[model samples]
Target chain A: MDIPSHITIKEVGPRDGLQNEKVILSTKEKIAWINRLSQTGLSYIEVTSFVPAKWIPALADALEVASTIERKKGVTYAALVPNIYGLERALQANIDEINVFVSSSETHNKRNVNKSISDTLDVIKEVADQSLFTGRKVRGYVSTIFGCPYEGKINLDKIKKIIDSLLNMGIYEISLGDTIGIANPLQVEHTLEELKKSFPLSIFAMHFHNTYGRGLANILVSLQQGITTYDSSFGGLGGCPYAAGASGNVATNDLVNMLHTMHVQTGIDERALTLARRIIDDKLGKRFSSHLLQIKNEQVKK
Target chain B: MDIPSHITIKEVGPRDGLQNEKVILSTKEKIAWINRLSQTGLSYIEVTSFVPAKWIPALADALEVASTIERKKGVTYAALVPNIYGLERALQANIDEINVFVSSSETHNKRNVNKSISDTLDVIKEVADQSLFTGRKVRGYVSTIFGCPYEGKINLDKIKKIIDSLLNMGIYEISLGDTIGIANPLQVEHTLEELKKSFPLSIFAMHFHNTYGRGLANILVSLQQGITTYDSSFGGLGGCPYAAGASGNVATNDLVNMLHTMHVQTGIDERALTLARRIIDDKLGKRFSSHLLQIKNEQVKK
Candidate 1:
């Protein structure tokens, strides 16, 4: 099957990958990494999240990083915003796009931002309103779409309602997130089949973790159902702080490699991404959760 | 999907899993594990291969193990027979089923079994005929179905020819083996689509490895396509000897867990399989390659 000509790689390395790192980078370091990723040809890079510094100390410098990071031509630097406060702060930072996240699992949403599913959606409405007023792009994320750690099977009706509400409020795109990576291909297909029947393929993207080792496979199923955009972290960075026993996001380089071999152009160079991974690994002083990073690192050593 | 009533968990742990272990198990230990696995409710157990003793000393006791091991009720104990000679030896041990494997990659075929693809098929024809004459079932394995470590991408036509040849020679089931474990859902779908054109879904089985972490995803894709029979090793114990970079097979307990959650029946007990893994790990002095195994091991310690 001929997949779409272009697939968008929304880089979550700066925000998602960095937030999970024990050694939090300075705002300047995060900005530099974002700029470097821009040069490496990523169209979208999520700079940081505007959550409480007390909750996510790594992104304590989110505002500074968002404001200061140089926006390259054609690069869409996005940031995660929890509510109207985070949204207003993001708007002030002049990001190209803004991301608002809620959980598909009720338990996850309750644990994540200390709000119920309804409460979180109520707040995100304000963010949507703010986006509409300012003419800024608002993207919605439904995390824990597959299996939730606390509640094993997530209600797909809830996922659909959240997506419908987000789409109804005029969100540009919605990402279906498998928060803990417990998703297999069938789950991905089963969820996507139901979602595709309702949502247009253009408005739906996928976010997957490799915790249970089905990240790329899940991506493939989504792609088959005509999904062309995805959110991934470089070196498999980023995890859910609220979800128990979650690992990093699906690796950007690994997805790039698979898509490239399938002749699906992802725009970002695999070699360049691998090089960036090497630089990141050296800076981090340990291995990332990515196989592509390790493979690239060994090739560099040789 | 009303998948096969019993998702036959072919415990390849004995042959497929142990062949890659750093330390070779004595005949007694390997036999003991196989025996214990038999008691744990696996329907199909690939005990060992009847290949050369010098080549695979890890399973040099293939004949003895097959002949002597306590054959449990409902367990179809099989052996890997490379050629007519190996099949003769398997016959000597009175294996219930005989499995013959061929790679879709010509390059891998030459390097792996020291024969060209066509030559390998010619040899298996003799084995298939002998097995058929004796009323012993013959299972065909067209391995590297997803991608090959040595040769890289494998073509669907190559896979088709191998499977068609095996079917023509009276093989009962054809297993599509992802030897390298690099298959994504899209590729698996594409391959299955092509295979289904020639063969009915009922006689097809899936064998997956988790090397690049796509094992379960591929299986899910297969399951959606109405595939019922799956071959998984206990504790995810198998690695490829010919395909060096491939990871262990999809864990039996993990497979059963995912299937059970999806409301599919495998007729296998995940808890008993978990316990069997403990027995294997205690004897082997190493952790098994399973998410449940690692998690349960820690839980037991606590």
Candidate 2:
């Protein structure tokens, strides 16, 4: 199996992770965490989401958080935008990239955004076009690409159509998410084998959840398929609010540790990433899930 | 990657898991756990270790645990035997198999058993000869085959020598262990690729720790290399007492989940395995570190 010499890791801790948590970090705390993440040699950081405050109080301070953090020289600071209103807010905050999300499963799409798949696609098409006109890169996220909590196995043809539509609308990158963390290696191989046939590897990334401990194994399969970009949360901070038993995104430290150990260079400062995880974990008054952080905690006890 | 159609899972929770815990279960508790494990369709279960009570107070009732459990028709009840004395005790308990372990790294060997590698080899040879005559299957475990806690990376030559010694002793299976949980897929591939040239696939198994969260990934690499049998603990119990933050063996549920999801038949009932995990977790008054168990807990909360 061929493995890449280098891979790209996008940190989504501030957005995806904190949104699912009960405790809310203050605007200052959010900026501090994002600022810390910027120094970790990561190319992209999904700083926050621009959804309505009433809908998600956890990320209500997204505007202030987006404007305050001192942007790093080489890092791209991005934000999740739900619709034209959220995209407008993100544009006001000067987000480097606008990320639009939709789920392949109809049940998940209706529950997550209260819209049908076609409506969500229309929004994505409109947002991507607007973002491109505003001189910003647009990233598309297809959630529940592997399996859905309500609908079970997602149709591969549906996912392919979504990807084709997103790519045609000037979306620069597309991240396929296993929202409920039900992906297996063979399932990943099957999905990618078919997906790669219609698209090049350059526009694709993987965002896996570690709810069932299949995150790294799925990543291994994807790496062999030559997809290099991965989206992760520091400290493994997010869980699906809709899916019971679904845990956080794969931890950035754990992902980097495996990548570096396998000689797949990620250019991340391991120490800096841990410090970033610690800052948010301490504020949340809990130790978030992370294999590297857990080991570090043990070392401290020793 | 060539994935196996079937894999062997040897449950080591009853022995290796409880041995490293702070709380010792009562003899009755141990018996109950083992009995529950037997109904889980597992073909092999390491019920207890035959070391003296002073060495492992947690499993002091190994003899009682061994004598009481109702063995399933096809299950092989095994125990960890330290030497001739431990093997003799195991023989008295009518263990279906006897397992002997030694570390590949000299520093780990000296710390773990207070014996030199050559001294340990002599004991294994003598014990294997005795066990063969008694008509019990002999399994050899080579710990720290990938990396060591004391010595960073173990020498491949040293591991080859250990395998040769174990094979010469008439041991039927040699389980390569990642004692410190520091194994990466590339490291596993590197070691297994070299080891496979000399040994047939039938004689090798993998014992990985989830300490750094690379357990499943390492297992994936090994499966691709055509190694089938795996050693795992229920609820991912059994941490490295010497190595800080070293979690227990990979959880049997997580292993089965990945294997079954990949269409690799392991003949294990998923619900039965979780029931086994619950019995131990409730008795210990703490949840162990299996990703699958943790998710199940979340589901129960909901």
Candidate 3:
């Protein structure tokens, strides 16, 4: 297969990974991990979320994480904003970028953020408008774009509509999250094929969870679709707050491993990513979801 | 995507998954597991291998396991053969079908079976002739159809040629094996697009390992291509002799869970597979690799 020559992975572990983790990371460790990822030449690093402490208290230190991280010159550090209030908080933190999620599956949308699809979109639109007024770039996320645990297979027509609305609202790049992690490569193939009909590949990114263990496969499928931007968690840490039993997002190390093997250049260093995963897994006192982190072999380069 | 109405899984745990495991099972447990799989309604089961004990001493109990298992009416039992001599042993064991493997990569063939590509072809031809003389159906296996751990990426043209040879040798069907579990769904898509030009969907099946955690994803891609029959290990058992630190084949339990979720009909029973995996994992003193077995929520439908 003629895969792409290079890909961009926006590491989101500091925010997405920690938000759902059971053992709350000391704000210091979270900052340390994000700082570690910064030195690896990553262009974008999601720092934290601005949700209230009552919701996802694991990231209650969001403001602390955002302000304490060591941001490199070219890196764009972003954070998840739940609404206009969260967006205002993000603006106060002076973050590089902002992200808002509206799940494609209505059931997940309600359960995830306690808002109906339309209601969620309204909040997102208002927040996007406000962000635009402030000259801050806002990225839109459409989670469970392909399949959902509660709803089964998703309607991609609905997915496209959400993408269209988000794009029309002047949001930045949209990431299609396989939230429940049930989608396979075929789903990815068809989803990208349909999305390509309306939007440019540069406007789209992929977020996959490793629930059924298809994260890397889905990422590879996305790569074949000419998608350069990806969402990965360091040490493969991160699971959806709503989807139980789902593993972490695609491990940063694993994604890099597969990319380097396919002769694709991912500007990030594989060794540094591995070390980041090691720190997280050791701190958590549990194994990280990444298989690459578990096996430290020099043979990874070949 | 219009997923297939049904998918056929050719359970290969007894032969493929168990063979490479360091722990050896006695004839009684082997017979028990093989017989248990029969009740699960798997149509095709690779129950044993006929290689020399010196080569695969773990399966030296092949004869006893093959002889003692109570046969089910609709299930077709099979064995893997290395050469004509292995085929003779399978014939003596009354194996309903025999499978032989050849590599698309010349280097893999040489390293795997210690024979050149042409020499391996000659050997397969001899075995096929013997199977024809004995009125037994010979199923061929094209191993490393994806990238090989030893040789890296394989040429689709060479693979089509090897498959053509197997077809011309009077083999009934050829199962394409991803020996290294590095293939993504697109690689599967890319290869199937080429192989289908020469081989019909009915004449081809897939043998996948879950090493890089894409077994189910790759299966979804294959199912979309109309390939029904698949090879899986119980509890995701099995490891490649070539890929160091790679995990087991896609767990039979995990495969069934996914297929059942997709509203596809497979005769296999998920609960029984889970029970069998528990037995295997308990005996081995470690967590088994199957994703379904790891799920604690246990929505295991009968």
Candidate 4:
């Protein structure tokens, strides 16, 4: 029952959401969407990923997207950078923050980045060093933190080691991802309790997918555990390519609606977020995984 | 988190689910589906409603459905009975339990039953008297306990009064319903805290809609408040006819999945439940509001 008065919501629709979508929006479209999100009072947005186009063709225009969007005064525009090469592109785009990712599961990390966990960390170390030297903050993402598609249950000791490495590398915050959306509230409470024993709870962020519809419940337990920051996509737009049967990230619209209803402020306007969702819905021409968006669609039809 | 080790799940798919669905299953289909559910280890199943066919044509075969379904040992087959007339029909069908419903919001009650709250309660009192005289247990449903469509925020005092009246009328347990699916965890905690002051928490059940995707989160908070019983539908069927934008009831599949993962036993078999869902899906031939079913569908497509 002890909930925070305010929460930090990191908008990841432009980057993670678009990357997994089948339809690739044009550079102009991406910029317009991000610009719309900027005006919604969101203080942080992961705009694009600087991965090679060959890896993620959907976000191929990352540099253009990061460079052209209208940046709000307090909003930190971040882009995911895999290594020094991607970091160079992000720096050239004048990104406000840098993000690096590695999977806690070995098989998932290899499938995601075509490298071992240690190798991925070695590369991230260089990226983090350069991004810090350039006066840009860095955030880390640990995917498959809850469970892995290939590996059933992950070893908590391995997750602790990966988090330790990311924190030591100057990554201010680590977003723990339920890549396949298989986390439950009991597991969330137990995991957070263990993680808090080693690190400050503030450095942890929850990135849940609504695949099995337990995302909000897990987030509720996270709130009770005193973790505040959350990463979500507008219209519930992202999924893990490596994980079959996985749905999209927890929709920002649904997350914000629940948070605001609980009197926990996210500083995001619901109507403005709906405007941004409309753009994505128009381009996709499909139903989203978001409950709020689906309900609104039903209302419009009526 | 003080979660209970065992919980009771009341499956209301056959009655509430089909009542809101556009497709109407034949008596044979309903019997077959309910038979499948009886095999799923679920102890309580609201098989059908005895209201007039003119009102809910989708479940017009309530008499045959309640009579024909295979009654497994340890299963309580229940049906909704609005008044003495419906109670007579349910009694003729030999239903194990009777359920009566009234909305907390006067407008919703008028719209739903063409009667005021007090008049509806009077009708329920008569039905409860008849059912109890016949050696049958009766359960009460208080709709729009969280919020109402026409009345906006319903007064909590009105809800407490309705619950008080139902309990006084020999209703064994009262199910508090979020008719519009607009409830949040904080609101759930606050409301449950207030209700517990006047009644034992064991006498209350949580019936939530997944309209805003806050169903499971609300259930989580209810668990923390020591409320053990929940009402859900297979494949997430049922929406409020009076609420314009409300979605279906929380999917029993999703609810059981989370409960089983949390080690809270529900005495239900997941695979057996999927068999029941398959029958509904085939008869309806449309997508359901269940997260687990949707993910399974994607896997089938793959």
**Tens digits of per-residue lDDT for model 2 on A166-232?**
9889888999999988899999988899887888987899999988887999999999899989999
lDDT tens digits, residue span A1-302, model 4: 78788999999988888888887888888888888899999999999999999999998888888888998999999999998999989998999999999999999899889999999999999999999999999999999988998997899999999999999999999999998899999999999999999999999999998888889999999999998899999888876675555558999999999999888999999999887766666776364778777767767778
Query: What class would a CAPRI assessor give candidate 4's docking?
Result: medium
**Candidate 4 per-residue lDDT over residues B39-69, each given as its tens digit:** 9999999999999999998888888889888
Provide the lDDT at B175 for model 2: 91
Provide fnat values for all models in the order shown.
Answer: 0.18, 0.73, 0.25, 0.77
Write candidate 1's Cα lDDT for A1-302 as tens digits.
Answer: 54676799999888878887776766666777777788778999888999988888889888899999888999888899998888878888987788999987888789898899999999999888888788888999888888787887888787889989998888989988877777776677787878778877789888887765567767877877789999998877765454433447898877887787567888887767766654455566343656555444544566
The structural similarity of chain B in model 4 to the true chain B, as TM-score, is 0.97
Q: Best lDDT goes to which candidate?
A: 4
Poorest 10 consecutive residues by lDDT, candidate 4 chain B = B238-247
Least well predicted 10-residue stretch by lDDT in candidate 4 chain A: A278-287
- TM-score preference between candidates 1 and 2, better one: 2
Clash totals for all candidate models: 2, 2, 2, 0
lDDT tens string, model 3, B14-68? 8887787888877877887787778777888999998888878889878778767
Rank candidates, lDDT, best first.
4, 2, 3, 1
| Residue A72 in model 1: lDDT | 91
Each candidate structure's TM-score, on Cα atoms with residue i matched to residue i, is: 0.85, 0.98, 0.84, 0.97
